[model samples]
Target: MDLRVSLQALMGRSLTRAAVAASVAAGLALTGACGGGGAGGDDSLTVGLLLPGGGASRFGQFDRPLIERKLKELCPHCPAAFAATPDPAVQRQQLESMITRGVDVLIIAAVDPELLRPSVEAAHRAGIPVVAYDRLAQGPIAGYVTFDGAKVGRLQGEGLLKAMGAKARGGQIVMMNGATTDPNADWFKRGALSVLKGKVKIGKSYDTVGWRPENAFVNMKGAVAALGAGNIDGVLAANDSLAGAAVSALNATEVRPLPPITGQDADLAAVRRIVRGDQYMTVYKPYKPAADAAVEMAIALGRGKSVESIATGTVDNATTKDIPAVLLPSVSVTVGNIKDTLVKDGMYTIAQICPPQLRSACDKAGLT
Candidate 1:
């Protein structure tokens, strides 16, 4: 039940046992007393991390660990508590749990941003500021950190068009998008449409809820049913997870020499898919920079200091005004730029991203 324990043990630790009777009493008093920002005394720090889904696997695999490590670096003696639940309702409950436990600052990737507003508001009322990570969480937040999602979609759209080649206009493509609950999903869809609307015949479109691969598969199957497998030319998948689902659906139907498919998040599997020529491109948002930016922002906010030095610009959530944000660039990763984007940025090493299974593909892609 020790809060100082590693995050892998959070589930095992009984939350009730960790907060001593005196600790709760003191926390309750602090809730009533201090509401203004600029941080409490630096004697101790508690940072609560709230991530959305487990489908992508990146949050737990990369983001969470990095955030925890960076926060530790900033405050070695401080406690970094983590809570990961896929359900939006569960996420709200987790945030409240963190707030009640007296977290100094919260970093959240809300599953359902709109629904989580009340929880975020409750945190603000308790003098705990929330930082929207990846997905924007509404309400009075301290800051935001994410990649340029619109640019990610734009790159996907452009890559899809390029891969469509001479069949461009005549080639019909289905679009499988991310959940509409997250504003980033909307931005991604909008950005892709900006380039794709007039150019290609959009066969069918469906938004995957919870960014679930099964949802993508079902929607893609529906698209294939409506448009006919042979008529479909390309597919624009919002992220690597959805793209993998799309690929699975296509393979199930025996759709081979697959039409160009575009995706975001240069996940290891996605990179391999590209090398194999099944997936055309993926948008590579440098994970290191994104993780570093989030860490820097969290540390700054934890210390009750201005994040202007780290913020590249600003972004708007529904309820929050111009929130300070660190927006990183996204690069289009095809076979041609695999080395330049993912490898050069140190998001993954050749061995990590390309395994023995993909050795020949890696060689062909010039990644070996």
Candidate 2:
């Protein structure tokens, strides 16, 4: 029942599929019943799912399906509407549309937390509760669900330091952080800095715009030119997309023996890059638990029930304070534990990670 202790335990070990499932089950049990109460016996409840991206993105490939599955499992008759876009304006319009549609509740992963504030306030005024999913949204949100952002950054910092080895002592690394628009980006940067500040010198730090790979590529290119590619020892990329861009930029500059890079979101491409020695490591935050928590919170809020039973903690945004929240633990993934963590947890398979070109590398990494 002690969330801190449970999260520490989860972070201390490489998680298998069964272990992750058990953790989710235990968390659900804390709420009494997984399918308890909703808009009129769950038969007439209408839910809206709003995401930041779709089609090959994490939201499209994993979070959306997992949330839909959980919604079906908990509320069989609850008809759900879905929309995804990377534009904050479009997302706000979608949120407004959902509000106009008079849905019982909404689960939104805001593209720009600040930009979506007015829309979230509108949803509140409309008497529809909004459950902030993944990214924290501003305004009177009923509940929130996401991975522990601080821990995710710490894992990346530690992983990068380990990969750097002797170079870590006097090494200069570039910090390619996420967009300034996302509060989670700041959370992650602060956490990484907590571990990285006293140890290494940050030669160039950039807040990538829109969390876009192209933007990260431009920033990394600038860093490589400013700091000299040979002088840069490591990179702390906020996510896999940025990590990939950093690698491309370094490759373009002819930086042979690519320096170690830390990344989050164990995207399939990122995993392949790890196998190919292009990236050092990535943080893997299981999506199912987050999705399940969001759905449960939406249902509970729809039925005029408190999410105290479902929420493990509380979080505050610029416009809201003491919002009930469930912050799940995340795992650090590298070539060394890819099998034990991601593969064992069914996030990916050996064949999917090891293609023909990577077959030999996979064998060397013992992923075969």
Candidate 3:
């Protein structure tokens, strides 16, 4: 059967609850059957899930599995093909490979959204619809799924400024942003700058490439060196990874009773650091809705159907026209409401965050 014809046939067959449950079971049962992501059953449609980094644990532990299961539910016979490459060029290569393998659709959370435009365009040329997942991809995309990045950045900046309190106007802040390649990184920086530009004196700024904690560490050291240890009152670290790096670098210097530091992702380590007063704030974008949205859109695209059913809005990429986009909101988490943002959302259990060492801190914060 030809690709489009086969996809049409699959779409014609409406999914039933029983069949979806069976498909979910089959997908979960046959884990390693697919190459890269998952590919096995003859009737199973393949979706290439391309994530940018291995450093962010959510992509693997949460996003990958959830997306796989949801797609399976949508198409009982289809299994997923998940591949996450750390290198952007390798990611482009993997995309081409998946297209060559006749995978029905492509879902990418690009390392470099703009840089991958050519690759995404290539996939569209092959008649494979591409969905920009998490990280916005700059090509003619069918769909996109991610939390509102600008809002996340604004929340981070506001949280930091609030923590700084009396010094909000006269304080000196160092800005350490995420990798330059990601559109999300730029949006994050833009949002933070909107709130921070008029509020504080930006002593120094650096864009941490690859979102690597090490790069953040190096950049942070430069900021402290340029601004002086005692003069810098706040630090805007884009995500939890960079925040941790910045904090570590800060401690190595004379800075003590750490200044307010902003972060996002609410990673386990970042939460712990927040408890310790090393980091003041972080943004929490719940992963479940995002995972579920990607799965739904991927299945529809795989079957050559409209993603309009699941999309919340439309977003335009540099090279792409209007693409269906789902923008989930992010919440700011502070020492005062860690339980509300993380615990209440079921993102983390108190047991996981409030270990024996953090038990007292959790109690003090009324986290228990």
Q: For model 1, what is the alpha-carbon lDDT of residue 205? A: 88
Candidate 3 lDDT at 291 equals 82
What lDDT tens digits, residue by residue, belong to model 1 across residues 283-358? 9776666667776777677787888777767766667666877777778989999888788877779898678888
TM-score (all chains, Cα) for each model: 0.87, 0.90, 0.87
Query: Would you give me the overall lDDT of model 3?
Result: 0.76
For model 3, the superposed segments whose C-alpha errors exceed 4 Å read: 1-43
> How accurate locally, in lDDT, is each candidate?
0.77, 0.83, 0.76
How far is 114's C-alpha from truth in model 3 (Å)? 3.0
| Top candidate (TM-score) | 2
Worst 10 residues of 1 by lDDT: 1-10
- Which clashing pairs does model 1 show? none
Q: lDDT: which candidate is best?
A: 2
- Clash pairs, candidate 3, are 34-39, 36-82, 37-81, 37-82, 38-80, 38-81, 38-82, 44-77, 44-78, 45-78
Candidate 2 residue-wise lDDT at 163: 94
Backbone atom clashes (below 3 Å) for every candidate: 0, 0, 10
Task: Please provide, for model 2 over 10-88, each residue's C-alpha lDDT reduced to its tens digit, 9 standing for 90 to 100.
Answer: 2211101232333222221111122222444557787878888878999989998898888889877777777788878
lDDT of 3 by residue, 57-145 (tens): 76776677777777666665665665675667666666666666666777789987767788788888887788888887877889888
